[model samples]
Target: MSIASAIVLFMVIWFMTFLIVIPFRIDTQGDLGEIVPGTHAGSPQNHHLKKKAWITTGITLVLWVIIGGTIVSGVISVRDIDLFGRMGPEGSMWHSESGSAAE
Candidate 1:
């Protein structure tokens, strides 16, 4: 893939992984029985964002390598997922071999 495409892929994977990782091991104020006077109890007591960020980066790297390698190696291509015969032939990028536009 191109540099921009690879960067975009990594960013997507990183953000997705961060979102999924955020909720894990969370210690809400309500769960700790120490609700602040002005803040909601459901707020995080201690986010530990630094540690979480490190963990997320580690996970993202591994996933990015595996996914990026697959894409770079072309082990799985768009044609594999053309459930409705969209790409028609293997080498065609956008149009099908039968002169039909991808629906």
Candidate 2:
């Protein structure tokens, strides 16, 4: 993969991780208040859940950054030439053995 492609892939992974983990962070009063119906406010279980969510979000963000940075930088060293044999010789579909002229 090229640097640009790797960057795009990293962005996609980062975006997906953000979308999945953002809902878990209880950084606001509204998030804390969205518990089960009739549940007591400021309960131990609620606080624990919020803490766990924040931790998970932090871990995910850290991992995403580390992995994405490594992947993007690694891809930067890749050559621009195509490694696959898709271009054929001289940019023509027919081989020399076929004795076919370029159309």
Candidate 3:
């Protein structure tokens, strides 16, 4: 993939990981019996956002490396997922196996 696509993929992965990790090990106001006067009890008392962001970045980097390597090495390609026969030399986009376009 191009650098732009790789960057976008990394961003998406990082955000997804961040959201998934946000609730882990959180200290909610209600859980600690320190609910602020007006805020909801479920509000996080110590979100540790910076730490979580770093962890998310690390996880995303590892995932990106594996995915990028697979893509670069051609372990998986677009034709591998063309379940409807819409691509490749013998698919809809090209000559079919019967050498007919109508098929």
Clashing pairs in 2: none
Collision pairs in model 3? none
For model 1, give the 10-residue run with minimal summed lDDT: 86-95
Best-to-worst ranking by TM-score: 1, 3, 2
Can you write out model 1's per-residue Cα lDDT over 19-74, one digit (the tens) per residue? 99998898999999999999998999988888888999999999999999999999
In the range 71-100, model 2's lDDT, one tens digit per residue, is 556754333354864445655656455466
Query: What is the lDDT of every predicted structure here?
Result: 0.88, 0.57, 0.87
Q: What is the Å distance of residue 57 in model 3 from its true position?
A: 0.7
Where in model 1 is the C-alpha error above 4 Å?
A: 91-103
The per-residue C-alpha lDDT of model 3 at residue 67 equals: 83
Per-residue lDDT for 1-103 in model 3, tens only? 8999899888998899899998898999999999889999999999999999999999999999998889889989898898987564733465655676665
Q: lDDT: which is higher, 1 or 2?
A: 1
How far is 38's C-alpha from truth in model 1 (Å)? 2.7
Angstrom error at residue 92, model 3: 9.2
Query: How many pairs collide in each candidate, listed in order?
Result: 0, 0, 0
Top lDDT prediction, candidate number: 1
